[model samples]
Each structure stands twice: as structure tokens, then as C-alpha cells.
Target: MAAYGYFLSCEEFSPSQLLEQARMAEQAGFEALAISDHFHPWNDEQGQSAFVWSMIGALSQVTSLPVTTLVTCPTVRLHPAINAQAAATSAVLTDGRFRFGIGTGEALNEHILGDAWPEASQRMDMLEEAVQVIRELLTGEQVTHHGPHYTVQNARIYTLPEQPVPIYVSGFGPQAAALAGRIGDGFVTMTPDADLIGRFRSAGGGGKPVIGGLKVCWDTDRDRAVKTVHRLWPNEQLPGELAQVLPTPRHFEQAAELVTEEMVRKATTCGDDPDEHITAVRAYTDAGFDEVYVNQIGADQRQFFDFYRTRVLPDLPRSR
Candidate 1:
């Protein structure tokens, strides 16, 4: 059994649209919310990237559902200490319902500061150190550290929630899973791979929650929906480390040109089939994920919510 949530894509929608979707998600019976933290859209047609911390503040005023960044990178572009403060403030604003989801991050966002992009292994080391720094700062005690990747001098977060913010670490492979298991309060990934979940548990994540998500297109016309996904999110089909290494939206667009509509159709659930959507989500639950988030790829969000409210959610297995 798992709790189902809606994923708010900052890469695809405006801040106002995201706030409205948060409201709609709660109203339509979603149990929680997952929002992407991106400095830029994957492609131009996606067209929007709001500062996620500011959007979180607005979300606090709009919805009562718990929110998690799915996820943010604390290792580059911004120091982990700065992110700790932002997460602390977000936790307070959400009344202790914010889950801090973090990762090693992608070059597309991290490279903007013109810092040399580290290799995968080095980035992993930096992520471990960044997580350590963030956790220490979240305790609200003054912290002074001279680590391999970061430096903090008597730094402390003045504002924090009554409970410490739970940090969910994201990973897509065995090494990263082991790191997440050893250090994370919870684990985040986009796929529902039971073997990966087992790897996490074996590495010491046994009692911690596992979170995953997927995207779908809901529309009256299946072909049109496929085209919408092809145009707006062909980047999703770009395989391997390309997503983590690509430096900019233009580069992503260039890479996405290799993706085809047939590929998008094969990978995503498109059109108005409730059973298809239900089955897509069930994959996560079946793979032992504690929570699963679903993102509607195109602009039919209100309709998607309504359809899920009436046709999908009631049929899914509940956590209880």
C-alpha cells in the first residue's frame, strides 16, 4: 500500500499555475505533493522555472498537503548551508510538513555558476559531504566544519520547525543507493525498481520510506496527447547520463531531437484511459515504494485531476 501524490513541475508551469495545482491536488484527494527544483527548463517549450523556495512559500498559503522537493541539489551552485536555511524556513512555513529531498544534481543547473563540473564519483563524494553539512545545520546548533568539499564557520539556522526536517536522498543506481541508505532519512528515485529498493534496504535503509514518481499525458485524443508529450518532454526519453551531463536547455533540445513520438508513447501513459493511469502508478506500489507521485506532462491538469478524482484514486490501494 502507498500514498499517492501529485508532482508539480516548475520546469513546465508558472508559479501561479503550480499554486493552483497544489490546491487542486488536495481538493482532488492527493495525499501529498512533490515539486521539482530547477533553475531552468529542460527545453524552451516547457518555458518556466520559478525559484522553488519562493514557490514553496506561496504553496504554504494555498494548500495543506505535505510538500517535498523532488528533488533539490545542495552540492553545487548553492552551498549546503544556504540550502539548510531555506529548508528550515520551508519546514516552518509548511508547519513541519516539508521533506527536504536532495541529490548530487545535474550539470544543467550546477554548471550555471561556471564551476567546473566534477565527475560522477567526485560529485557523489561532494553530495555525501553536503548532506553532512546540511544535517548538522538543521540541528539549529552552531556548526563549524572544514570538510573536503565545504566550509562552515559558526553557522546556525535561526528558524526551524519543531521537528527536524526529514532529508530524502535521491539515487538511480547501486552506489548512490548505498550512500542514500547509509545517510538518508528516506530515499527518492523516479523508478519503481524492487531490486534497487532491496539494495537500499540492505545498505541500511530498511525502515526508511521509499519515494518514486512518473509522468503521463491525459487528453481526449491519444495521438494529440502523444504529440504534446513529444514536443514538451522528449527530454524524458533521452537515456543514461545525458540528463545529468547536458549543460543547457539548448543542448537538451538538441539531444531531444533524437527522441521520437513512438518512444514517448511507449514510455508514457497517454490519453484518457483510467486503467492505464492506475496501472502506471501501481508499478510503484508493487515495487514497494511507500509513496508515488504522478505528473501530468501537458496542460490538461484540471481535467487530469478531475479524472483521477472520479476514476483513479478511489481504486488505488491505500496505506492503511
Candidate 2:
């Protein structure tokens, strides 16, 4: 069945705040939870980036809902071997409820290492290699790998769960989606793009689940919510390859200046009415997503949960 989930922007809330939100989300009937894994908030104004791993540990204890990273980059800030170990432990802690969702990454987060950011093609290569390394390590066998981007010697995860954690890969374009289909157990993308989903399945994803998410805001004042989203997440509206190539948050902020609040409002659903949120989610459902997750942007956490549970969830058609 298609699953309904919520995406938590970890950088936007304190750990305690997130713990509360998770509990509320569970009680409100969300089937799963996906959290953003970023070393830094896209901009400092967004305010928080509590280490995601630590937050995940706390989340496992606070709620019964399954938690996964919306997408984490295993090739850069953290090595695949270490990531594998972390995922294994998290899976055990969550009682096999963890899914490792990963992607090629953004310059805003990965470029902090002072390493020259490779081109997309190279990054994909690194991702493929990283996935192999991670999978091998999860086997609970000694692994020694010498790859173009990574090397691990005699590594074996001692804290692995009874089952290997499923890896869901996020992609935007056709090539990346195809890569996810070929290598990932499931496919993840933010866009509600049916063509991309078809390409992924055609490229060998088979019957694996497809997950997509969109941002929304639940507020009595729609205009204010749109303005707030654009002010804080203007980077969402920047088009083209610039997002991939921008080297710094300042660059992002500069480019983001060109995106108007209207653009954000047009792209996202923001309003007091839960129907608006349901319509936004329906776009993803109609686009052929196996699962659609909604992310409530800005604060107003309690109101957002209540809006979804009382007004939106009841109206959504059950996934077939």
C-alpha cells in the first residue's frame, strides 16, 4: 500500500522540539517520518542543525513511527563504512524500522571539506561505489575496498540488525533516477514527476516503492505563510543547474533573492484550509508516487499536525 509520511526539517527545529513533533505526528496518524540530514541549514536564518544522527537516536525512542533520512549523502561528510555502521545500529534501535535514503549531495553541504566538488557524473560514480561499500559492510563480513573515491580496510559492522537496512536513493533527473532504480531497493525524489518514475521502473526498479514529498504550510493566513516560506526557503524556487554549482550559502541567498513569494506560493500549497494541503499531496499521488510525504514548513507545528489529522487525513483516499 502507498504510505503517507511527514518530512521533518531537522535544521529548522531544536532536538527537543523535534521529539515533541515526532510524538505529535505519530499520534496524528502519519505512517512514517523522514527527516532532513544536513550539516548546516541552507542558511543561518533557518536556525538549527542538531546533529541528525543524534536526533534519530532520540526519535527511535520517542515514537513508534519508522524514520528515514529524506536523503543523506554518504560519500562526503560521512564515509559509507561509518554510515553503514550508524544505519545498522539505528535499524536495531528502531527494531528494523530504519531506511537509509541517500543522494549525490549538494555543494552547500559537501563542499565544506575543501575537496574539489566533482561533476554530477563523478558524483554518481562515487555514489555507486559508496552504495557497494555500504552494502558490503552491512553483510557483517570483513570488507577491504580500494575504489576511485573511497577505501576501507578490514571493516565489519558488529552492531548490525537481523536484517540489512533498506537503502532508498533520491534522484531528480532521469539519469539519477535510473541509477537509483538499478542500485537502490526503493526510489525517492521530491518532484512529483511521473515521467521520472516511469524511467526509474523501466530501468529496473521493478516493484520497489517510489517516495516523493512536497512542502506545505497550515495557517489561517495564507499570504503570511507563503511570505515566510519564501523568506526562509527561497532556494526552493531557484531553477536550473545553479543549485548544483553554487559554492556557498551566500551564493544561494543571492540567487534566492530573485525568487518571489508568488513563485513559492504557486509551487507549494500554503493555507489555513487542509483541502489545500490535500490538493498539494494529490499532485504527487496523481503523478504515480507509491508514497507521498508532506513537509510542513515554518513553525506552527501543533496547528499543522491538527490540520492534517482532523481535516486532511480523513479526506485522503486510501492507498490501493
| Deviating ranges (above 4 Å) for candidate 1 | none
lDDT of each: 0.94, 0.87
lDDT of 1 at 259: 94
Worst 10 residues of 2 by lDDT: 38-47
Q: Which candidate is the best by TM-score?
A: 1
Provide the TM-score for each candidate, comma-separated: 0.99, 0.97
Name every residue pair that clashes in candidate 1. Answer: none
Cα deviation of 217, candidate 1, in Å: 0.5
* Residue 88 in model 2: lDDT: 94
Q: How many clashing residue pairs, candidate 2?
A: 0
C-alpha RMSD between model 2 and the true structure: 1.2
